[model samples]
Target: MQNESSGPDDIASILSNPILNTDSYKASHYLQYPPEASAMFSYIESRGGRYDRTLFFGLQMLIKEYLCRPITPAMIEQAKAFFTAHGEPFNEAGWRYIVEHHGGYLPVRIRAVPEGSVVPTHNVLVTVECDDPQVFWLASYLETMLLRVWYPITVATQSWHLRETIRGYLLKSSDDLAQLPFKLHDFGARGVSSAESAAIGGAAHLVSFMGSDTVLGVVAANHYYNETMAAFSVPAAEHSTITSWGRERETDAFRNMIARFGKPGAIVSVVSDSYDLFAALNAWGTELKQAVLDSGGTLVIRPDSGDPQTIVLQTLRALEASFGSVVNGKGRRVLNNVRVIQGDGVNPDSIEATLATMDQAGFATDNIVFGMGGALLQQINRDTQRFAMKCSAIRLGDEWHDVLKDPVTDAGKRSMKGRLTLLKNHHTGEYRTTTLPVAVEGDWEEALVTVFDSGKLLVDMSLAEIRSRAHAHEG
Candidate 1:
């Protein structure tokens, strides 16, 4: 974890970890549209979330790892092992053919809803194309790679919703709009599925937030999006940090935090519910009031247990009574010098409730920030957005065959047919899906932008651009 290496050494060491393109199933080589047939796949649809479009991510990682490089003998050996494990025929010919035909690039044109566009449900997010009929199979091979985008996209959309929610409350309850982005802190990293998930989900949150503790998210934003620093974290204490000081000296623990991190205007958060919540509040109001006021910084008290809403309300009332309150421009009671952050049991619903309750109590929304964990990241699945990539049309022989599945049992499983075109209605600003002949011309706002083609990254989107679009609700 402490390796201080760069460039060749890091890439060499990291690349040593085997790459698994899960969707490149061992049987995919054989299952592709026959050599005699041609096909185009529309990597269509994500059916959930508040945002119309998903934050397109993970493609660069997939392309760099699997497409940019040539297939090695080691890769073929691994493929063989896969075939043996699956009890299927080894696809030496198919893979070799792929290498010979593909050279060192993915021979497909991927047009997608721009990185941060508001893509509507049932509209094509991505369309896959290849001039070579035999290359149609590559579409499914890349499914696992591209479909994985939903995780980050869904998380980004969820965070965006939370941001919007907070923004609304803040607009109504407070005058400060600039601090809205940092309202919801990302505390979900440790609760995610993996280091990669943490990086992706945490970065997604950064698209709508500026507060984060997941260092890997910083690395990911920089590495993938050309960002110098997408997020910042304040020095804060955890349960262990406070508990290590012992319950007998909890007040001292609070003092030590002020002494060390007491920079004027610098924020430091302390978990205050280690023992008796009420006692801690009493000490913070009486014993710690002078330290907090004189520290020239904001003291964020974190209550990590009990009912989140109730605890938040109690904390707010207690702090207002003890530390006193200041009336903001909105004529609301803003906690003086100190704020409470409810980190436990925080989610979109609870955050909304907490803000509403705070508003009703004549407290400004800016009086506190939110820290969310499991519900922020791992609580969602693919179905949360109903995301799926499928073949909307297939060309076989000389005819364009429209492909769709109209399941009798479920209409939601049904798909669109024929060549698909995503169009933006200029007036209503909503997206519309249409089928067009390959050479058809019409008055349409072409929605899908080419992202990757023939092993080249046609577009390298920056995190800043995506964040701007996402925040502006322009894309």
Candidate 2:
């Protein structure tokens, strides 16, 4: 990458901007100003206010393009008022300060699996460096973006794999593949850490598949794409009560629920493990079916407490016997209109196992939906994933410094250092890593290019565009 110093005019323009000097901007609230601003004013004066231009450029671009921009002036003003009322000075600095004061800049290169690539554990997902001796401090902060960007990708990629596996089985078992459309719903948000993370993670998963998030992931996804997102889902219900050792429910409770939701072909999820599931199915199943049909809705019996494969098979058979008929527009016979959804302890391995059992018992997997919760979000232990990241190099005075971290206990925790070049194997198409000298004795244009320069983003991608890129790579 070519390196250049920020000119006087550029520096002047940056300093003169109102956003840099005043608390009127919400970003300014992150600055360390006010009483400290007076003390730091001298520090600013002493250094002529010239920080790392390259770092500042990157920070500015991120704030402008990624973090905050569509934020209204009213919102900024509101934040300023709130901070002032709380007696907290709105003094803030961008990531540049975190990067520069923390470490000196060294030339670093990063190689990652294109966003949608299905990556396995122990892979060197990303590599970083700085071009100057003093800029190595920047490596620490990169984790904020690196982890944030990559974790959701990893989780979504795994979810997509599971969906693919399930779809394969469904296609094989179903008599008419065209009758059923594959739909994957995201019910993991309630189990996630925070609402924002859930939305982002949910949206990422939805990019590769389909889902209905408890929170507003669809809206956030639209903003990420810079366009409207078109997504919908089957309206669903939760478990209200369970009978002891039976599937029977108080008829009044069921009647009340159907009335409130105005059942319009909606999915009513009931916990069937409270009683003998078969007895519950035999007694209440017929009444529920008639009530659902009368209400212009279809009953989706959810067996949350029994062996999923067994419950699904029994429910399908019972429904077929009671309301047997020829196939409808949605493909399955009228009896299949009342579907089966299984939840609780539904992990990838368990799902696979359940599908095998269903196949053995001659159950139509297409007639059921999977409402996964904690298993999809938190069940996949990170220890099993074996994901690691490292900064392998720094640019020294006319040379490259190699830095490697030897694993202490875990075999997959080691990292390779030095200026490394990523090469693609022509035949196998796998990435090959090679160490290189910091300085190019000859012109090598392919070696490095400016992605983010002087704190400005040269490449901007819409969410839809990125999603399309991900899908294309999968193909």
Lowest lDDT 10-mer window, candidate 1? 11-20
Which regions of candidate 1 deviate over 4 angstroms?
Answer: 1-20, 23-35, 49-66, 438-444, 473-475
lDDT of 2: 0.48
User: What digit string (tens of lDDT, one per residue) describes model 1 on residues 1-475?
Assistant: 6666654335443344222354335364545455566656656677554455565554554445455566555566666666677766665665666567776355778877776665657677777776566556666566766787878878887887788899888888898888887898888888988988888888788888998888887788878888999899899999899999999998899899999997898999999899988899999899888988998999999988998778899999998888788888988888888898888999888999989988988999988999888998899999888888777776677777777888999978887777777787655667787777444235447777777888777778788888887776522
What RMSD does each model have against the real structure?
3.9, 12.7
Question: How many clashes in each candidate?
Answer: 4, 36
Residue 169 shift from truth in candidate 2, angstroms: 0.3
Residue ranges of candidate 2 with Cα displaced over 4 Å: 1-113, 120-124, 132-134, 148-150, 175-183, 241-249, 252-280, 294-297, 325-335, 408-411, 421-429, 433-454, 458-475
Clashing pairs in 1: 52-119, 53-119, 117-475, 118-475
Task: Summing lDDT over every window of 10 consecutive residues in candidate 2, give the lowest-scoring window.
Answer: 39-48
